[model samples]
Target chain A: GAGVSQSPRYKVAKRGQDVALRCDPISGHVSLFWYQQALGQGPEFLTYFQNEAQLDKSGLPSDRFFAERPEGSVSTLKIQRTQQEDSAVYLCASSLRWTGGTEAFFGQGTRLTVV
Target chain B: SQQGEEDPQALSIQEGENATMNCSYKTSINNLQWYRQNSGRGLVHLILIRSNEREKHSGRLRVTLDTSKKSSSLLITASRAADTASYFCASPTQGAQKLVFGQGTRLTINP
Candidate 1:
């Protein structure tokens, strides 16, 4: 129970609809990451937040994807005009820092389905 | 683009059997890490072997890194049904900001 937690384990949305997914990282973790995992593929990075500052967002597929960690602890990933291609498991991970060689903790992820 | 490639995309073995997965990467890495995902769940960290380390072990898991060959292998001895999952290898390539992952090897342990 002391691990990363993601809200709304499953989400179903109509095409073009908007949805928001939330993630609560492990307590006191300084770095949080957002990744998208399509069926039969590995997780791809979306955005990374070091505390409240979003340092990298190069992996966001499109402008429709927006993520914020206003308080540096709880983060939200909002997708606008969701497309069928956007239907994938969104995973949230946290670590002590953004540097390599650190073990990261992950949440069970939110499965988003758009039809 | 994927940074690593895992061979034999899937493997199945009986309980108590051994399972092996191999991963190859293109660029030099600071470290290589292995993770496991059960069904549609999140990934759990399994082991990490630095580029300089040739081999390491934890419990029934054994990891070997061959930097010269730019590849790595994971061996699970006496695997159990609980080990059924998709195993991914990730590398933090030099000067890369994020870890790049391989397609993964789906391992099934039949009871």
Candidate 2:
């Protein structure tokens, strides 16, 4: 319960539909990250937040992918007009430090299936 | 380019045997980390080796870093069936950005 928590461990969506995934990071963590992992592949960075500021979103595959951490605590990753390629396990991680060298705490992740 | 690439994409060994996995990165890194993921679960942080550190150990896990080679290796001694899972190596780029991951090595410890 002390670790990161993500909602709706599994989700099914139709192609061309929109979906929103939620992540509640450990309280007071300064760095939050979202990653996309395709089946049998490693997680790819999607975006990052240092508190409420989205410092980098270069990994977002397209404009259809958008993520926000409005209050710097809970974050949402919303995909608009999702396609089959968008199906993957969406992972959320948080670290106490704002830098890269620290170990991050991860959530169970939401496995999204699109058909 | 992928920041971290792991080799021998998969590994299988018997219980009580040792398992070793390798990883290489493309760019300079402040530190390298290893994680393990069980089926349908989140990744669990295994260890972190800084650029300056050559070797570190935690329980049955041993990690060695070769910054000159821009590579690292993870070893699990006296493996157990419970160790069966996917192991990944990740490196952090930029001063304070995020972690880039490798495809990971699927390790199976058969009894």
> DockQ of candidates 1 onward, in order?
0.75, 0.83
lDDT of 2 by residue, A59-109 (tens): 999999999998989999999998999999999999997577789999999
Writing each residue's lDDT as its tens digit, candidate 1 over A20-76 gives 999999999999999899999988888889999998899999999999999999999
Docking class of 1: medium
Clashing pairs in 1: none
lDDT of 2 by residue, B1-111 (tens): 468989879999999999999999989988899999998999999999999999999999999999999999999999999999999999988674889899999999999
DockQ of 1: 0.75
In model 1, the runs with Cα more than 4 Å from the true position are none
Give DockQ: model 2: 0.83
Interface RMSD of each: 1.1, 1.0
The candidate that achieves the highest DockQ relative to the unseen native structure: 2
List candidate 2 stretches off by more than 4 Å: none
The lDDT of model 2 is 0.93
